[model samples]
Target: MFSFLDKFSSPVKAMLILTFFGIIGSALVAVSYTVTKAQIAANERAVLTHHLAVLVPDNLHDNDLLSDSLQVTDAQALGIAEPVTVYRARYQGLPVAIILNVVAPDGYSGKIYLLVAIAYDGTLLGVRVVSHQETPGLGDGIEERHSNWILSFAGKSLINPLENDWKVKRDGGVFDQFSGATITPRAVVKAVHHALQYYWEQRERLFL
Candidate 1:
């Protein structure tokens, strides 16, 4: 008749206990990671779907934007360290629009992230400020809820305003800058311009 620890010495019993618990802990961690990973991915998809819908109209695309996506690793142009994901919207087997995730590395306070929607013909459908840390009431005008300044970017493109006219009013551009917040708008304008440049360079691959 063997007791729980009868086959092992005192030291061996302690080692066995630790090993048992170690295995249990590792398994728990693996299980937790698997479940949490799936949840995180689902939440991310839902958020992307919402952003795409806001930028590209519902009737414009027939396929799933979340599934129809590609990644671009750009730092100097995009102002981001990680790979940027470009979501494509297709209509009736043809490319309709491409929504880009871009960052303005020179915002007043910090980076001003954006989701820019561009049509197949190089026209801007919409622009949404994803995140920013600019001063309240002043730099916040870039946000749609704060003011309509953001809407001014709609129907715009590289040639629409002319490349040189992409700057803020303070710098002699077509767009207006906030009374006391020039840096924020300036940064956003430059960023939007860069996004267009990127789309132009990758238009062939993007449409494919």
Candidate 2:
């Protein structure tokens, strides 16, 4: 009886001790994550805002647009993979630009996430890929480092997408398509066209 008590008691105590430590460790991790959450998100936003400035190329009078979050479904019947958020920026109380999420799921490798900004008059201010699963060398030109290919969309309006204007040079569009990189550019062009169509169809919901 004494031997049994000794053996079982130690195992039970050890388990209790381990359980306590596990609980404490989990709590600490949760607390740390909670405390740093806001700061980390703010830092991320700052980086994106800087990128937006590069895309938009206008003096930021203020950063108020970052604060104005809008619902995606309220304005349009977004595709399942649509960007998660849209923000409307204002200059001196007037709507200057809109920053919205766009996703091109037809990317050769997978979906490509984008942040697109357009002026009230439907002019594209800037476009930045927020996330993508495109091939490394070829499709990556959609990124800023490879080339300014995506930048071609800037200044274009929905009124003039010129689906005729939506191809790589090989395909005879005003833009240059990558060598051995047709699908990626095609997906991007289609996504941009969709975004424009969304803006055109839902202009009232967006502006109001």
Local distance difference test scores for all models: 0.90, 0.74
Per-residue CA lDDT of model 1 for 55-155, tens digit only, reads 99789989988789999887877879899989899999899999999999999899999999999989999899887999998999999889999999989
Q: How many residue pairs clash in each candidate?
A: 0, 1
Give candidate 1's root-mean-square deviation (CA, Å). 3.7
Candidate 2 local lDDT, 142-207, one digit each (tens): 998778888888888756657677665677776678889988888777777777778767766774
Candidate 2, 122: how far from true, in Å? 1.7
RMSD, one per candidate, in order: 3.7, 4.3
Question: What C-alpha lDDT, on a 0 to 100 scale, does residue 197 get in candidate 1?
Answer: 90
Residue clash pairs of candidate 2:
162-165
lDDT of 1 at 49: 74
Whole-model alpha-carbon lDDT for candidate 1: 0.90
Q: Which candidate is the best by lDDT?
A: 1
Q: Write down the TM-score for model 2.
A: 0.78
Measured with C-alpha atoms, the lDDT of residue 53 in candidate 2 is 72
